[model samples]
Target: MIDFKEKVSETLSLRTGAEVTIEWRINIKGVMTGWCRLREAALILPAAEAVAGLEGRLSMITAYLSDSAKQKGVREIAFHFDLDGTTLTLGIELPLEGARIPSLTPLFRNADWHEREFMELYDIQVIGHPAPRRLFLDRSIDPAAFERLIPYSTFSNGANSKALWEKVMARSGNNRKELQ
Candidate 1:
């Protein structure tokens, strides 16, 4: 099997109309893994298109806010794809507030679940999602409760309460009265 290194770069460059950079490493077991940090968040759609053109499969999507990223006022999302058994991860950076990214569900049907999970976990806006709604969370819980409401150490502590909602609303810059 051929490595997707060059093909992926060429395809992404063509689709994004920019020099797409990708780093690849092969494990001792001969499985290849690739990484590409998109220059801008808006470029993700084009990059996804490029990967789809290469017959890649969307394997996973991960959104994170590291302490450094929070300090820098940004969050990050990584899209992992399987290109003929090789792994390629594309990283995108977005603003901490009002972060929005176009939906990849149109290209990868599996993206719907992960996109919804992002909304439930981080308050990310998945624009143009075919169907957008709460997956498992209730309307009372903060959209970004994992980050804003509960401490990471006690994420599953079942701390959902009226007072917690008020605190989250205040921290989110929304009036606590809104929860009334």
Candidate 2:
């Protein structure tokens, strides 16, 4: 069997300009696990016993990231995959001004809700999604106010919401800090 983890690392390092890292982790069951990262892209390879076909393997990683977003309260997700088993999953904790959601619909049909939820909650625009219409937000509410409420309500009250909003707006220039 191919050592997919090593192949993935070598492939990404050769193809992309970004520096990449690889790590092996164990789940509660103590099984061998592997994942790789290039900049914001994350690639997860299943345990040897659980490995499957190419499409199935990629689907598993995307599903894992989706569940992770739900657990982490991430409002947006930008994910894509290339030929060499390199997958990118961008978890947006909160939306920032001018944030553009990457289009995964072209790559995976299942990415529809993941992108829609990101748009509805974080107000991040998903470029080239087939159905870009609003998903969860009430159409009646103003778009600006809708964006305000999604992240704001996580705080205790209006004051805390305003403070958080100001912080988000202020850090728009830097991608590293905007999600914080």
Candidate 3:
């Protein structure tokens, strides 16, 4: 079977002279499962179209927006495609500063909600989204409030609980220094 990466690359090269770079992925068990990635976020539409032409089905789309992403100066969005019984993920990197990417909802119905979610949470504008409205957050909630919420890494029990307790105590002027 032709690897999805090669197929996607070849198909896209024929359609457009753009290059699609593939990075092989290894599962948790250390087994090389598949390869993924295509082009920058700006060129994602053409790469996605090529995958679609190969009879690939869009499974889901996810956006990773965090302090780390901001630090790296990248906005990574992954488009998961089921191509010929193999799962292929196309990751596109956009600039973190004032990020804007063309919406895929015009071509794929499944892209609607995913794009909206990214727009609301990450503050990355998805231009041309059909329903350009708040998905989870209403108007009352501050747009940047999403970032203030606890990140997955800091959401654990023991250490995070102690940190939270210390923070509250410090704010209430009941910290160790004040108590002393």
Candidate 4:
């Protein structure tokens, strides 16, 4: 019931000296959701602080490359926060070559997991993270596994077996044309 969209917008602008906008939507169930995109990547720190001041908890983080973004040569990372059952997402765009963002573990402990996941999967650098170690990925796997369009079989060699995916497809009665 705080209607944090305004407070967050004001806090971000006051702290970073940049105007921030948040779009809010209320579903039929009365749940509120907000989205905002920061002008600069460094502004996320102050933005996160504003949410933390409001007793918001970091819920999840996601990073990805969309077709349009890929054409633009940039990747995007979105940070989600849970504030009294309301959800707010703050997103930033990063260059594809050097995607780096500050770690939010200090303000939100659970951010450690989400940060690590994005680091390995998307080749993002969570600068200042306490322990920037691998969580799900093994050392053998290359970083930024999702950055390119590689075949699933090529990516998961140890997954099933040689041609196992094809075999499974055959067993499932699906053809390559149907899959394509």
Candidate 5:
């Protein structure tokens, strides 16, 4: 497990040429939960390492595909790496704006539906995917309308939890006392 994490960290650092954060959480069953995040693009290495490391432990990997907003025209892809004991799930969030889907079918055979789902839901262009078709979205809906439906936000959690909770309770319908 340690070797796997190290490999991923090294590869991501080398490929993206950015600082990558590596996190590992061991569940009760002693299964390792690993994740790496890069500021820019660091998809291939991280994906490859996760697959390689969790080969025996992985059961399935599910990709949740989406894209950036239409206005920006900048592609932002995010991947959720899940290593289920039986199946490893890799949830890939494609950019809604200027979306480009990299072909993972060649590397991971299970990524076909994932790519399809992205194409269907967010109208992302999945290049080189063997079968690039709609997975969940209705064929009736126009592609332009579908793009608007996708949520666009930059997510970050570097705030004080206690303070944030107090503010939340104050605004909530139920007026509960804040815990000090």
Candidate 6:
């Protein structure tokens, strides 16, 4: 069977008439990881254009909120669309300082929950969201918890979080400043 990554990439590029960037990820053991950057900021226009042009079922939407992102003043939102057997991931960058992105729930019914999650967790504003409510951790939940991540070492008894971090840094090699 042909690779779904290539087919999905080609289809989206052709459909959108934009240069869609595709990155196929593979793990150390040569196992295919079902994660790819199907498109970049170049594809991001109006939310309506994306909803109408891309013919697919929205599988999931992942929002990344980080301290560095807060420093940089932008959040990264990824939309995963499943077209038949293939999956296409579209990356959308949102300003964290005062994020107010158009709601995708109007176009994709499933986006309602995901959008609400980000709004509550990351304090983002999803404009025109149908029913923006708290999915988990009500008003009483500490807002500070969302700002910074608690190191796993806090919970571990003898785990050397520093050593683990050093290993991760060694693996990554390049000291690229990731938004976190």
Expressed as tens digits, the lDDT of each residue in 1-180 for candidate 3 is 346557666886665567655665656764443455555666777767777788877778878766787788887778887765566777777886777888887668888888777676675778888887766655644453344584433433224666567767877888878456
Ranking by lDDT: 1, 4, 3, 6, 5, 2
Model 4: lDDT of residue 163 = 61
Q: Which 10 residues in a row give candidate 4 its minimum summed lDDT?
A: 154-163
Q: lDDT of each prediction vs. the true structure?
A: 0.86, 0.45, 0.69, 0.83, 0.51, 0.61
Of candidates 4 and 3, the better by TM-score: 4
Per-residue error at 134 for model 1, in Å?
A: 1.3
Question: What C-alpha lDDT does candidate 6 achieve relative to the native structure?
Answer: 0.61
- For 63-155, candidate 4 gives per-residue lDDT tens digits of 988989989989898999998898999999999888789989998999888888888789789989999887777666788888757567656
lDDT for position 28 in model 3: 77
- Ranked by lDDT, the better of candidates 4 and 6 is 4
Question: Which regions of candidate 2 are displaced past 4 Å?
Answer: 31-37, 40-95, 142-147, 150-180
Per-residue lDDT for 160 in model 5?
56
lDDT per residue (tens digit) for residues 1-180 in model 1? 343567788899999998988888889999989999998988999999999999999999999999999899999999999988989999999999999999999899999999998888996899999988877666656687667756533454335766566667777879856645
The TM-scores of all predictions, comma-separated, are 0.81, 0.49, 0.69, 0.82, 0.52, 0.57
- Among all candidates shown, the one with the greatest TM-score: 4
Tens digit of per-residue lDDT, candidate 2, span 58-170: 34222122445546654433233433434333222332445554555555666677666556555466677899766565564344334454544433333466655665676
Model 4: residues with Cα > 4 Å off, grouped in runs: 1-3, 149-159, 162-180
Q: Which one wins by TM-score: 1 or 3?
A: 1
Give the per-residue Cα lDDT of candidate 2 at 61: 20
Candidate 2: worst 10 consecutive residues by lDDT? 41-50
Comparing 3 and 5 by lDDT, which wins? 3
